[model samples]
Target: MKYHVVTLGCQMNMSDSERVISVLEEAGYQWTDNEEEAGVIGILACSVRQKAIDKVYSRIHKWNKWKNNKNLVTFISGCILPDDHEKFLKLFDITFQMKDLPELPKMISSYGITTPTHLNVGIDPHNENIEDFWNVQPHYQSNFEAFIPIQNGCDKFCTYCAVPYTRGREVSRPSKDIIAEVALLVAQGYKSITLLGQNVNSYGLDKKGEELTFPQLLREIGELGKRMKKEFWLYFTSPHPRDMTDEVIEVIAEYPVLGKQIHLPMQSGDDKVLMRMNRKHNMEKYRHIVETIRRIIPQATLFTDVIVGFTGETEEQFENTRKAFDEFKFNMSYTAIYSPRPGATSHRWVDDVPLEEKKRRLHQLTEDLRKHNLPYNESLVGQTVRILVRGEDRKEGFLTSYTEGKLTIRFACTDKSMIGQFADVKITSASDFSLEGELVEVAASC
Candidate 1:
C-alpha cells in the first residue's frame, strides 16, 4: 500500500503527520508524494483560523475526485476542530485523532494489512525502522535541524483559539522517552533539535510527581548537551507567558547549547482585551516576565505573536498594544488580523472589528516594529556570532542558519560540508530581518 499526506498548520501538526507516516510504514505502507499514485491519503489539517478550515473544505472535492478514480481510502487527522469533525468525517472514509496513531496499524490490519505490534498505549516508534523515525534515512525530506515533538496539545483555551478543541488537553511525553530520542538523533549526526509543542512551557505539567516544566526540561536538556562530546543546538517554541518560569530563563542564560531566543505569545497587549480573550495574564504581569527574562539573559532575542483587531478593541486599546510592543522591542513579531474561528468561545460574540481597520492596525504595528528592529540588527554589525549552518541562502552563494537569538544570518563559507556544522561569523552588514556576515572559522567534526 502507498499513502500521501497533506499537512497544514503549525510545527506540531507537521510532527504529527510524520508520526502518522511512521505508523503507516510500520504496517507495510509505502509513501508517495503524489496523490494520484496512492492507495490511501491523509489530510493533516489545521482548524485554527476560519480561512484554514475553508481551504480544507475546498480540498475535499480534489480528494473525492481521487477517490472516484482510484478508490483511495482517505484518512483525515491532525488539529481538527471539534465542530468540523463530524462534517469532515463525512468527507473522508476515516477520521481519527493524531494521538490515536498507535492503533493505526491494527486498524489497517482489519483491512488486511499486516503489522508487528499489538494496539496499545505507550507504543514506541522505535519498535521498527527506528532510524527512519529519527529521520536518519537518506529518503527523508530535508537535511537540517529537525523538529522533535516532546509534548502535545494545549491547556490555554484563549477565546479566539481552536487548538484546545482540536488537539485535546495538554499531554507531555515521559522525560526518559524524550531524552532517549534526543540521544538517538545526536548519535545519528543531527546537529540541531527543536522541541515542539502547542505550549512548550507547559510540558510535563500533567505528568506524575514533581512535574518537569519547560524550564526544568530546558535545564535537563542543557545538561545533556553539555555532557555530549559533540556540539549541537537546542530550541523550543510557542511558549505561554503563564508558564514561562524563571528557571527556564536561567537555563538559557547559563547554557550556551540552548538557543538564546524565546517565542512568547502575547495575543493582545491591552488588559481589557486580554481579559476578553481569557488570556489570564495582565499587561503588568507580561512586562514583569519580559523584564525578568531580560535580567536573566540580557542578550536573549525575543519574538512574539500579536493579534490585531480583536473584538471590542478600541483605538486606545490598540495603542496600549503598540506601547507593549515598543516596550518589549521584539526581534520579530507575527501579526495577524483577528478572524473569529467557529466553535470557539469568542466566536459567540460579534466580530465587530472592521476589515479595513484591522488591516490599518496591522500596518501600523508592522511599521512600528520596523523602527525598533533595524537598529537592533545594526548593533550586531561587528560582533562574531556562532551559527549552525543549515542550507544555502535563497539569494546568494552564502550559507545560512540562525544565531543564538534565532536571528537568520548568512555568511560565505569555504567548506561545502559546513552546511550542518556550526561556524563563527563576523557580522559585516545588517538588515531588518537578516544579518550579513563573513565566515570566520568553521568548527571541524562537531
Candidate 2:
C-alpha cells in the first residue's frame, strides 16, 4: 500500500504530517510523492486562511472523482475548524482530530482494507490519548533541519485567528520529551532545529507547576548543545508579544545554539485595531519588546507578522501602522490582508475594509518592509556569514541557503553534496528580500 500526504499551512502542520507519515509507514504503507499512485491520500489541512481552505476543497474534489474509478481511502486532519471538520466528515472517507492519529491504522482497516493485525487497537478516552499523539515518533522528513513541536494549540483567542477554535486551548508537551528529541537530533548532526508552537513563549504556563517554562526549556537545550559540543542553530516561531518575557530574551542571548532571530507577530499596529483583534498587547508593549531585543541581542534579526486593512480600519489607522513599520524597521514581515473565516470571533463582525483598500494596504506595508530590509541586506554585503545550505536555487548554477539570522541567500556552487551542510558565504549583492553571494568554504562538521 502507498500513502500520499498533502500538507498545507505552517510548519506545525508539516510536523503533524511527519508523525502522520510515521503512523502510515508503521502500518506497512509506503509513501508516494504522486497522489495518483497512492491507495491512501490524506490532507493536513489549514483553516486559518480562506485561500488555503479553497485549495483543500479543490484537491478533495479531484480526489473524490478519482475514487469513482479506484480503491482509495482519503482523510483530513490538522488545524481544522469545527465547521470545516463537520463538512469534511461528509467529503472525506475519514476525518479525525490530530490526537486521534494513532487510531488511524484501525480506521483504515475498518474499511475492509487489510492492515497489520498486531497493530495497537485501543484508544484512550482521556487526555492520555493526546499525550500518545505527541509521543508518536515522527519519521522526520529533513536530514539537516527539523521542527520539534514544544506546544500545541492556542489560548489567546485572538479575534482574527482560527487557531483557538480549531486546535483548542494550549497544551505544552513535557519538557523532558522536548529535550530528549533535541539531544537526539543534535547528536545525529541536524544543522537546524526549530521549536514550533502557535504561541511558543506561552509554553508551560498551562502546566506551570509541572513543566519547564519557555526560558528554562531553552536553557536546558543550551546546556545540551554545550555538552554535545555541536554547532547547530535552534529557533522558535510565532510567539505572542504579550508572553515574550525578558527572561526568554536573556536565555536566547546566553545560548550560542539558539539563533539570533525572533518572529514576534504584530497583527495590527493601531491600538484600536489591535484591541478589535484581541491581541492583548499594545503598541507601546511591542515597542518595549523590540527595544529589549536590540539591547540584549544587538545582532539579532527581527521578523514579524502583520495584518493590513483589518475590520473597521480607517485610513488614519492604516497610516498609524505604516508609521509603526517605519519605527520598527523590521528586517522582514509576513504581511497579510484581513480575510474573515467562519468560526473566528472576527467572522461575526462585518468586514468593513474594502478588498481594493486591503490590497492597497498590503502593498504599502510590503513596500515599507522592502525599504527597511534592503539596508540590512546591504549591510551584509562584503561580510562572510555562516549558512545552512538548503538546496538548489531556481536560478540555475546557484544554490540556496539561509544564514544563522535566517536571511535567504543564493550562491554559485557545483557541489550538490553541500546541500545539507553548513558553509560560509561572502555576500556580493543585496536585494530587498534576498542576497547574492559566493561560497567561501564549507564549514567542518562537528
Candidate 3:
C-alpha cells in the first residue's frame, strides 16, 4: 500500500508524523507525495486552532467524495478533541489516538484482508521505550536541518492551551538516549539540530530526584561537540518563561555548538492575564529572567511568543504587552489573536473582543515588535555570521542557510555541496524576514 501523510500543529505533530512514516515503511508500505495517488491517507491533526480543525474537515469532505468508488482508506489521529472525533468518524475510515499507534500494522493487515470484528481501544504505550519511536532513522526532509524532539507534552496546563489535554503531561527522554541520537546525527553529516518540545524547559522535571537532570542533560549534550569533534549548530524551541533556569542559560552561553537564539514564550505581558492563565510568573519576574539572561550572555538573541486580545483584556493591559516588547527589544516575536480553545479552563469565559479589534491589536503588537527586530537585522549588515547552508533558494540559484542565531540567510555560492556544511557569510543587506549575504569562507571539514 501507498500512503501520504499531512501534518498540522506544533513540531510534536511533525515528530509524530515522522514516527508514523517509519512504522508504515516497516509495515511494507510505500509513500507518495500526492495524496490523490495514495492507497491510504494519514492526517496528523491539531485541535488548538479552529481554522486548523476546519481545514481537516475540508480535506475529509474532499477525500470522502473521492473514496466512494476508490479503495483508499483515510486515517485521522493526533491531538484531536472529543467533539472533533465525532466529526472525524463521520468522514474518516479509521480514527485512533496517537498513543495507540504501534499496533497499527495489525489493524491495517486485518482490515486489508478482512475487517476486524473487535473494536480497537486506545492504549498508552510505555514512553520509556524511547527506542520504539526514536530508534528508526527518519527520512528527514531537510539535508542540513532536522527537528529532534527531546521531550513531549506540557505539564503547566495553561488555562488557554489544549496541549496538556491532547499531548498529556510532561515526559523527558533519558539524557543518554538524547545524546546518543544527536551523536549519530552529527556522524551522519547533519549540520543543524533543533530540539523540540511543548515546554523544553521542563525537560528534567519529570525525572525529579534522579541524577540526570535537565542541566546535566544539556551538559552531556554539550560535551558531544568536543567528543564527536563536530561544529554543527544545536538549538531548542518554545521554552516557557517560568522554566528558564540559570543552569540552562549558562550552558547555552558556554557551549559554542548551542545556538545563540532563545525562543522563550511570554504569552501575555499583563501580570493579571498571566495569573489567570496560570503561568505562575508575573511580568516583573519575566523581565528579571530576561535581564539575567542578557547579563550572562550579552550576544544572545531572543524571540518571544505573545498573545493579544485575550478575554477581558483592557486597553491598558494591551499597552503593557506592547511596552514589554519595546523594553525587551526581542529579535523576533510570534503574536497571535487569542481564540478560545475547547477543553481549556478559559473556554467558559466570554470571547468578547470584536474580530476587527483583535486583528488591530495583533497588527499593532507585530508592528511594535518590528521596531526592535528591524534594527537588529540591520545591525547584522557588514558582520560575518556562521551559517549552515541548507538548500537552493526558490527564486534563484542562490544558496540559503540558517545562521547560528537561527536567522535565515540567502547568499550566492558556487559550491552546491556546501548545502550540508557550515560556512561564514558576510551580511550585505537585511530585510524584515531574511538576511542577504556573500559567502566568506567554508569552515575546515570535521
Candidate 4:
C-alpha cells in the first residue's frame, strides 16, 4: 500500500506530519507523492487559518469522490477546531487528533486493511498521549533542515484564535529528548534546526520547577554547539510577546548557533484592537520586547505576524498598525486578512470588517513593508556574508540561500552539490525581499 500526507498550516503541523508518516510507514505502507497512486491518503490540517480549513474540505471532497471507483483509506489529523472536527468525522474514513497518532494504524485496519500492528490495543488516545506521539521516530522529509517540536498545544487562548480549542492545554516535551534529537541531527549533517511550539519561548512554564526554562534550554544547546564545533543555525518561531523575556534575548546574544532572526507575532498594533482580540499584551509591551531585541542583538532580522481586520477594528486602529510597520521596520511580515472562525471567541461577535476593506488594509501593509524592507536589503550591496545553500532557485544557474538573519539571497552556482553546505557570498544587487550575489567561498558541512 502507498500513502501520502498532505500537510497544511504551521511548522508544528509539519513536524506532526513527520510522526504521522512514521506510523504509516511502520504499517507496511510505502510513501507516494501523487495522491492518485496512494491507497491511504491522510491530511494533517490546520484550523488556525480560514484558507487552510477550506483546503481541508476541498481535498477530502475529491478524495471521497475517488473512493466511489477505487479502494482508498483517507484519514485526517493535526490541529482541528471543534467545528471542523465534527465535520471531518463525517468526511474522512478516520478522524483523530495528533496525540492519537498511535491509533491510526488500528483504525485503518478496521476497514479490512490489515497491518502488522493492527491488533495492538489498550492505547488510550484521549489521555496524555502526546508524550507517546513524540516517542514515535519521525521520518523527516528534509535532510538538511529539520523541525524539533519542543512543546505541544496552547495555554494563552486569544479571543480571535481557535488553537486553544484545537490543541488543548500546553505540554512541554522533556528537554533531554529534544536535546538528543538535536544532537543526532547535527551529527547527521543537518544545517538548520528549528524548535517548534504554539508558544515556543514559554516552553518550561507548564512544568516550572522540574524542567529547564526556554533560556536554560537554549544555553544547554549553545554549550553543546560550542563543544561540537559545527556550523549550523538554530531558530524558533511565533513566540508570544508575553513570554518574550530579556533573558531569552541575552541567551541568543551569547550563543553562536542561535540564528539572528526573531519571529514575534504582533497580531494588532492598536491597544484597543489587541484588547478586543484578548491578546493579553498591549502595544507598549510588544514595543519594549522589540527594543530589547534591537539593543541585545543588533544584527537580528525582525519578523512578525499581523492581522488586518478584526471585529470592530476602526480606521484609527488600522492606522496604528500601519505606523507600527514603519516603527518596527520588520524584515518579513506575514499579514493576514482576519475572518471569523467557529470555536474562536471572537466568532460570536459580529464580523464588522468588510472583506474588501480587509483586503485593502492587507495590501496597504504589504506596501508599507516593501518601503522599509528594500532599503535594508540595499544596504548589504557590497558586504560579504555567510549563507547556508538551501537549494536551486526558480531561475536556472542560481541557487537560493539565506543569511544568518534569514534573508533570502540567490547566487550563481553551477554546482548543485553545494546545496547543504555553507558559502560566503558577496552581494552584487538587491530586490525588495531577496538579494543577488556571487559565491566567494564554500565550506563543507561538518
Candidate 5:
C-alpha cells in the first residue's frame, strides 16, 4: 500500500511530516506524492490561521469522498486546538496526538493493516516527553537541508495564539538525543539544519536542571560543528521576544555554525496592542533585543513576524507598527492579518480591526520591507559569497541558492550536479527579496 502525507503551516510541520513518512513507510506503506494513488492519507496540519484550517477542511472533504469507491484510511495531527480537536476526532479515521505516534500502526491495525511495531504496542499511555516519537528517525526530504525538533509545545500563552491549547505546555527534549541527531546529520553531509519550536528561545526552561539551556545547547552544537569539520548553517525559529536574552546573541556571534539569520517576532509595535496580545515585553524591551543583535551580529539579516491588526487596535496604534518598519529596517517581515480563532484569549474579545484596514497595514509594511531589503541586497552587488545551491530555479537555465544569512539567490547554471553542494557566487544584480548572481566557485558537499 502507498501513503501520502499533506503538510501545511510552518517549518515545524514539515519536520513533523518527515517523521510521519518514516512511520508510514516502516508500517509497510510506500510513500507517494500523488494523493489519488494512495490507500492511506495523512495531514500534518496547522491551526494557527483560518486559511490553513480552511485548506484542511477542503482536503479532508475531498479525501473522504474517495472512500466511497476504494478502501482508504486517513489520519490527522499537529497544532490542532481543542475546539477543532472534538470535530477532527469524528472526521479522520484515526486522530492521535504527536506523542502517540508510536501507536499509529496499532491504530490502523483494526483495518487489517499491520506491522512489527503494531505487534509491540499494547495500549500503554505514552510518556510526556514523546520519547518514542523522538526515537523514530525522520525520513529527511532534503539532501542538503533538514529540520531538527529540539523541543515540543508552548508555555507562553499569547492572547492571540492557540499554541498553548493545541500543543500544551513547553517540554524540552533530552539534550543528549538532540546532540546525537545533529551529529549524525552532519556526518551524513546534511548542511542546512533548523531547530524548531513554537517559541524556540524558551527551550529547556521546562526541564531546567535536566536539559541544557538554549544557549548551552547552541554552544554544544557550535563546538560539535568545530570538531565535525563540516560546512553547514544552523538556525532556530520564532522565539518569543520576552525570552530572548543578550546571552543568546553573544552565543550566536561566537558560533560560526549558527546561521547569520535571526527570525525575531515583534507581533505588534504599539505597546497597548502588545499588551492586549499578552506579549509580556513592551516596545522598549523589544528594541533593546534588536539593538543588541545589531551591536553583536552586524552582518546578520534580521527577520520578524508582525500582526497588522488585533482586537481594539486604533488607527494611531497601527501607525506605530508602520513606523516600526522604518525604525527596524528589517530585511524581511511576515506581516499577518489577525483573525480570531477558538481557544485563544483574543477570541473572547471583539475583533475590532476591519479586514480592509488590516490589508492596508499589511501592504504598507510590505512596501516598507522592500525599501529596507533592496538596499541590503544591493550592497552585496560585486561581493562573492558562499551559498548552498538548492535546486533548479523556475526560470530556465537558472539555479537556486541561499547565503548563510538565508538570502535567496538565483544564478545561471547548466551543471545540475552542483545542486546539493556549496558554491561561491558573485552578485550581479539585486531585487527586493532575492539576488541574481553569477557562479564563481564550487566547494565541498553541503
Candidate 6:
C-alpha cells in the first residue's frame, strides 16, 4: 500500500501533513509522490484563502474521477472552515478534524483496507483530543529543518482571519513536550527548528497558571541549547502584535540559538485600516515594538505580513502603508490583496475596495518592498554568512540555502552531502529577492 498527501496553506499545515504521513506509514503503507500509484490519498486542506479552497475542489474532482477505475481512499484535514468542511464531506471518502488524526488508521480499516495492526477505533471526533494529535511523532520531511507546534488554534478574532472559526480557541501544548521535541531534533543534527502557532507569543495564556509563558519557553530552549554541543537556529511565526512583549525580545537577544529574525505582521500602516480589520494594536504600538526589537536585537532582520486595499481602504491609507514600507525597510513582506473569506467577520461588510485597485495596491507595496530589500542585500556583498544548504538550485552546479537571518542565497556547490549541513558562504552578488554567493567552507556536517 502507498499513500500520498497534498498539503496546502501555511507552514502549520505543512507540519500537520507530517503527522498524517506518520500515521499512514505506521499502518504499513509506503509513501509515494505519484498520486496514481497510491491506494490512499489525503489533502491537508486550507480554507483561509479562496484560492487555496479552489485548488482543493479542483484536485478532489480529478481524484474522484480516478476512483471510477482505481481503488483509493481519500480524506481531508487541517484549517478547514465549517462551510468548506460540509462540502468536503461529500467529495472525500472521510473528512475529519486534525485532532482526530490518531483514529485515521482505524478509519482506513473500516474502509476494508487491512494493516499490520488493529489500531484502537471509535475515538470521538467531537472531543478535544489535541493532546493525542500532538503525541503522534511527525515523519519529519526534512533532515535539517523541522517545525514543532507549541500551540494550536487562535483566540484573537481578527476580522480578516478564519483561524478562530476553523481551528477553534487557543490551546497550548505542554512546555515539557515542546522542550523534549526540540532537544531530540537538536540532538539528531537538525539545523533549524521553528516553533509553530497561530499566535505564538500568546502561548500558555490559556493555561494561565499551569504552562510556561512564551518567553519562559524560549528560556528553557536556550538552556537546552547551552547544554548541547550542536549549533542550530530557533524560530517561531505569525505571533499577534498585541501579545508581543518586551520580555520576548529580551529572551531572543539573550539566546544565540534563537535566530535574529522577527516576522511581526503589520497588516496595515494606517490606524483606521487596522481598526477596521480588528487587529487590536495601533500603528504607534507596532512602531514601538519595531523600535524595541531594533534596540535589543540590532543585527536582526525584519519580516512582515501586509494586506493591500482592505475593505473601505482609501488611496491615502494605501499611501500610508507605502510610507510604512519605506520606514520599516522590511527584508521581506508577505503581502496579499484582500479577499473576503466565507466565515470571517469581514465577509459581512462590503468589500468596497475595487479588484483592479486592490491588485494595483498589491503591486505598489511589492515595488516598495523591492526598493527596500535590494539595498540591504547589496550591503551584504563581500560579507561571509553561515547558511544551511537546503537543496540544489535550478542553475546547475549551485545549491540553495538561507542565511542566519533567513535570507535566500544560492551558492556554487556540487557536493550532495552538503544539502543537510551548514556552510559559510561569501556574498558575490545581490538581487531584489535573493543573493548569489560562493562557498567559503563547510561549517559543520550533520
Per-residue lDDT over 10-123 for candidate 3, one digit per residue giving the tens place of the 0 to 100 score: 778887787788778988999999888888887988989888888898988888888777887878888876667666666776776655566666666666565432223332
Residue 120 shift from truth in candidate 6, angstroms: 16
lDDT of 4 by residue, 136-232 (tens): 8899988999999998888898998888888888889999999999999999999999999989999999899999999999999999899899988
lDDT of each: 0.77, 0.88, 0.79, 0.88, 0.85, 0.89
Segments in model 3 whose C-alpha atoms lie over 4 Å from true places: 86-91, 112-119, 123-131, 394-397, 442-446
What 10-residue stretch in candidate 1 is worst by lDDT? 116-125
lDDT of 2: 0.88
How would you encode candidate 6's per-residue C-alpha lDDT over 1-446 as one tens digit per residue? 99899999899999999999998888899999999999899898887888899999999999999999989888888888877776776787777777879889888768645532232222232426788999999999999899999888888899999888888878899999999999999999999999999999999998998989999999999989999968999999978899999999999999999999999999999999999899999988999999999999988999999998788999999999999998989999999889998789998989998999999999988898899889899999999999889998999978899988999999877778889888889999999999999878643432
Q: After superposing candidate 2, which stretches have Cα over 4 Å from the reference?
A: 112-128, 442-446
Q: Give one digit per residue, the lDDT tens place, for model 1 in 47-162.
A: 87777778788877787976556766766777776667767756766666655666565555554342312221221222232223333111224455777776666778899987
lDDT of 2 by residue, 159-237 (tens): 9888887887788899999999999999899999999998999999988788899999999999999999999999999
Question: On a 0 to 100 scale, what is the lDDT of residue 442 in model 1?
Answer: 42
TM-score, prediction 2? 0.93
Q: How accurate locally is residue 122 in candidate 1, as Cα lDDT from 0 to 100?
A: 28
- Structure candidate 6, residue pairs in collision: none
Residue pairs with colliding backbones in model 3 are none
- Give lDDT tens digits, candidate 5, residues 1-446: 88888999888888888888899889998988899999888888788888888888899999899989998888888878777766776677877777888777768766445543332222122238477788889999998899898778877789998878877777777889999999999999998999988888888898778888999999999999999989989999878899999999999999899998999999888999998888999999989999999999999988999988899989899889878888988988888898997678898898888899889988988988999889889999999998998999999988899999889999988678888888899999999999999877533321
Candidate topping lDDT: 6
Model 3: lDDT to the true structure: 0.79
